[model samples]
Target: MKTMKMIAIPAAVLALAGCATTPGPDELRTNAIAMMKASFKERGQAKLDRIDQDDMQRLCSEYVGEKVMPKEIAQSLEKAQQALIKYPADGKLLGDWKLGERIAQSGVGKQYSDDPKKPAGGNCYACHQLTKEEVSYGTIGPSLYNFAKVRGYGEQIQRYAYGKVYNSQAFSACSSMPRFGHAGILTEEQLRHVVALLMSPDSPVNK
Candidate 1:
């Protein structure tokens, strides 16, 4: 009886140790999310819900430390995102490039202090060299100078620009660019204007 009891005691200890050593993916994800949620409170327009990851966001988060995502996974994510893009009702994809320039320059929305009633800014200049005149710009994204001149002004290019601006993830999975239209950061008209800013030959971007 004593020999049998000793063996069972060690087996029980080993089982307990095994449980303590490994946490599954779901548990780790849940714990991480809970910790993140506890770190911040809702501030005005920025609510706690923003912390919750959608399907694409969660997959992107899973591949964070990797240098490149798996091709199959990336393609799947892009396909899903592409389906979600909402194009303008009218066939017209371009709006006033002048107005588009303003939206691109302004960075005055989506903050706690910013007025909710006012429109959000695309802040395009912050990341891309949109015009030759704007010397100070971020290198995070590629230069957009002579965008239409390089890409060519055409219906297909215009459609690609509009879709990309609406949801960058639709083209590139886990892109740093915001899903402007998908996230409701930009309205349909605002998206059209931004597309014009990139596609219009008369716009400074193309000049």
Candidate 2:
């Protein structure tokens, strides 16, 4: 009985030691990505490549649901994203605010069911309170109500707004906001409209 007890004790200790061994970050990441790729199917505009992450995206994914990214890493990622932003050639930032409002309210685009020929929407309301009349707005992003009034309706501010809508990650790394222009989700004209919606003095957003 004593000999049997000694053997069982070592066996139990070995089992516990094995259980304590945690997978390394790279191993965990590889397993997770492989599982995701295996689970999802490509459909329409949504291809398998969409699951693949770029350098910044992979970095962000590694930190997500685990811990906040280090400040240096975040800043580095933001700098890389900012470098990719493309401004208009005509130097005009603002567009028709009325059309901008429509684009802001729309949530249609980039889905498998969506018609590729049709213009995609900014869907700003999905993450922001753009107008006072909008009773239903998401809290995921900050409110832009009276944006121009508070931020000042200037060329600089307009340019900033346009760039942010184009690539939110340029300003905030790993931001939940989509990179509309960077991802080709919105056209240059559509981006201008969205910018106008936020920066126009006469727009409902400013009121």
Tell me the TM-score of each prediction against the true structure. Answer: 0.86, 0.88
Show model 2 residue runs off by greater than 4 Å.
Answer: 1-21
Which candidate has the top score in TM-score?
2
Flag regions of model 1 displaced more than 4 Å.
Answer: 1-28
> What is the per-residue lDDT of model 2 for residues 58-118, given as tens digits with 9 covering 90 to 100?
7888787759899999998899998888999999888889999999999997788888888
Model 1 lDDT-worst window of ten: 59-68
| Top candidate (lDDT) | 1
**Per-residue alpha-carbon lDDT of candidate 1 for residues 1-207, written as tens digits (9 for 90 to 100):** 999999999999999998886788789989988998999888899888988789899888878664568999999999999999888777889999999999999889998889999999998878888999888788788999998999999999999999999999999999999899999999999999999999999999988
Candidate 1, TM-score vs. the true structure?
A: 0.86
